[model samples]
Target chain A: MKGQRFLGLGYLGPYIIGLLVFTAIPFFGSLYLSFTKYDLMSSPDWTGLANYERLFTRDRTFFKSLNVTLLYVLLTVPLKLAFALFIATVLNYRLQFIGLFRTAFYVPSILGGSIAIAVLWRYMFATEGLVNMALATIGLGPIDWFGDPTNALLTITLLRCWQFGSAMVIFLAALQSIDKSLYEAAAIDGAGKVRIFFFITLPLLTPVIFFNLIMQMVQAFQEFNGPYIITQGGPLKATYLLPLYIYEEAFKKFNMGYASAIAWVLFTIITVLTLIAFWSSKKWVYYAGDKRS
Target chain B: MTDITTSNDLTMDETARAKRRAGLRLFSTAIRYALLFLVGFVMLYPLIWLVGASFKTNSEIFSGAGFLPQNPTLDGYIKGWQTSTPYTFGRFFWNSFLIILPKVIGTAISCTMAAYAFARFDFPLKKVLFGSVIAILLLPNVVTRIPQYILFRDLGWLDSFLPLWVPSALAGDAFFVFMLVQFLRSLPSDMEEAARVDGANSLQTLVYIVVPMLAPALISVCLFQFMWTMNDFLGPLIYLSSVDKYPVSLALKLSIDTTEAFEWNRILAMSVLAISPALIVFFAAQRYFIEGISSGGIKG
Candidate 1:
């Protein structure tokens, strides 16, 4: 018994200690700091509800950021997953150069949201960049992709969607796991290709699709790099995401307390959305080997 | 079932069969080609444009016609290398590498050990601790930044690599820990059990038996941490103030800060130089860059 206890401690001590010092302490500490006003100088004043109240009622940028973030999530998640599924379905077909195609499609996913890519995006959308040049070739005048508020969000959306590599890879794995005999059976039943896709593939792929959707949504909600690098909260705050706002508050403005409040709000929003997703998933998601349904 | 109905169906099929087959072939080919073109454009155009722009002179870049550079030159590359002061391309790359190597090693070692403990052992409070780790993934980094910054500040660890590097020694990456735990759990315990039956202690079994089995997972984690830490900008931007300590990412940003009035050729060239190491690393380890979606919920 003593040996087992000691072994357990030996195995767990470093993790526990690290978690306590880094994660647990910071988590609770930040939660506490949300209620106080400290500028990293004097003693923190415990102001009850001031930060929260200010965010909801008074702060203009807070609402702007919330709207921008919501827009980003809504636009990016669905299109990205759909594109991933489409690519996965296409790749599922046995082809001669499938490996090359897969790698080509995946390279962008790996490099797409990187700071380099973001800088690239900035240049591409600049007034005299490639996009405008392409537009001019067909006698269509150039549109300001990053400069215009209406179009800037779309640029970021497209950027997010371009990195559908991870999701595509996941969908591909799921597609591969599906029994070949199922497709054979469908074909033997005189079902056309479209019918087989709808009746067999789509139904079976629902779980992966749902998984990709939720993950992409959460990730899209927390997206920072593209807008931060490309637009920097935009010509008119069009790309001002909540995370960016929180960052600006903390580091740029040195308002740690206010930033903590933004952080907590973002957390609550994510938690609520995640809860809703889990609840709705019971109706839609079909886990294989789960016989309860 | 009548002969008249059968004859009518036969005639109809015979007339349309050839036409329909031709149409189907055309449609499928079109669909395939269309997909090829669209996906190709989406994947390649931006990257190609970036590469093209990097070689373009200022006047040609501002000219902005099509994907090709009408007057492409190596001016940008030359200028990007020469422009920055106190933060040259080679120096920043070395700085970035210095930070990345330690963080990658730290994450791999600490996260893997923690993962093994979580996966194999049935210690007290294991469930709660595991949950806390996963939950921290959702806890936004911004929330913790202030308290962590303060902690580092009080310790006088700010402006040095310690603030960035030390926590990594103590299982800084919960995502990696969670990933390794899931992977370890999926493997059968028979090997370790046999080793234990032969009088191998838990630590011995872990070091010799389990760690060997976990080679691929460890490598993947290491590569991921290397890329992430290499490309990390905000942490280095916030922590390291001195120009000498600035990593390539921060250095690149500093170069681009004067984007409007500054030379575009140099800026783009420097950006290329800054990101090349990560790009090279990623491409080299490209085969193992598996998108393991199932590992998303894992926390260290």
Candidate 2:
């Protein structure tokens, strides 16, 4: 211990090196690359704000992708969170086979984001497929799930939302940790179930809700597997999220500089939004974690 | 006589009221379970359909919204296993194993070491390094994907599995490292202190004393890395271009993209195979998975 001022560094060596090589370098490298025009075949040439200017000014696809991504994030995050909370609240009740219900509800979150689920979603929503057959059983006509622009985005959004089980499990943990005495006191005070939930339970749950919001928002922004597989950013690029656009531009179109610019813009957008959430959390997210307090 | 009759009537009324309340409670319980069952069924129906539909013929796959196949067959599984590539589905599964085994093992060792250092040692630049870990956790992979790809390409790491697993092996996943740090912080250091006093070296104490205590958390990390690697589409898609070297995720998609006529049943069959590993593992270790996610809610 006496001669070990830098012994900790020995422990940290591999990680530090990995961090430097894989993360720190690439992070700034992309930033530098964003300002230059580099195709894979040639060396990068300095392009000074040209990519950003073009993206903002002339690139219709860029704007469309941006619009689509924002809409997807906004739509999916709230829906998923709401479903998770609702299910968690219901499942929190003392009931028979509660664990079984929880497992059944959670199975989708594990399998939902996979390529298999995406493929299943594609078929289930296909024209003249299972969904249509079910609709017909009720004497309703078939709705175009992926063929239409509006439906295409909705289909992709549902895939993201179906994986709400993880968020629900988090909420369930937070909910279970709430003091039973608080609920007993609320009942003794002649508070209705709804009243106590809104006044007591909801406030206590804000921290978990905020955490889920941040995690889900990040994921919804970068949804790739669903959109790519199900709609392929199709029905007129309605499902063309920024990640999809990034993939297409960088890999398919060989637009490395432009793609990096898009990626940086994405990073900036997420950072600013997260910052705003943090700033706003002071108003709403109470960290009264200690139940006695 | 009049007083007795009135009291008797009141008792009867009270009895009826209690019975009604009990009936209402039963009804509510029934309603709650019904709703849970309905939602659970709907949530699981797609997976159920996938399994059942995997056995259906190509023509029958789209025949209805039903899950039960009329003439159940193994045709889809058979043909799907053969795949379009010269390499069969077995090859892809092996590739996935190759990636996951090392990646999960490496994550356990590397992240544990880094987390131990961060949690216990007061190294120079500790604050800055830890801050960078959080920053990396928050940073989207999209920003770094291209540069990393290029770097790997430069090092001739492309078209191989090295690029996929090596980063994780080195504790490049800050989320896992941070998770381990959070876990390590919660653990008491008394046993480790005793070991050190007994003249055990840091690594020796880590290997012998700390690891056993950290087993639950380490299991959680390994399971997460395993499932994530299995479900990863983008990594394999980006790095491994050869048909023979494809993981199940890529192999599943290769059939979809490379074929003209959609072999729906075969795809469905392969889809079942793809998700089965995650499903099996999840049920096997449900406790650790939920505990990790609840404690570590930031996993994406």
Winner by DockQ: 2
The window of 10 residues in a row where model 1 chain B has the poorest summed lDDT is B291-300
TM-scores for every candidate against the unseen true structure? 0.91, 0.95
Which regions of candidate 1 deviate over 4 angstroms?
Answer: A291-293, B1-30, B64-72, B259-262, B291-300
Q: In candidate 1, how many Å is residue B3 off?
A: 16
Docking class of 1: acceptable
Error of 2 at A33 (Å): 0.8
Best by TM-score: 2
Candidate 2, residue B208: Cα displacement in angstroms equals 1.0
- Second chain of candidate 1: TM-score? 0.86
C-alpha RMSD by candidate, in order: 3.7, 3.0
TM-score of chain B of each: 0.86, 0.90
For candidate 1, list the clashing residue pairs, or say none: B174-B300, B177-B300, B178-B298, B178-B299, B178-B300
Clashes of each: 5, 0
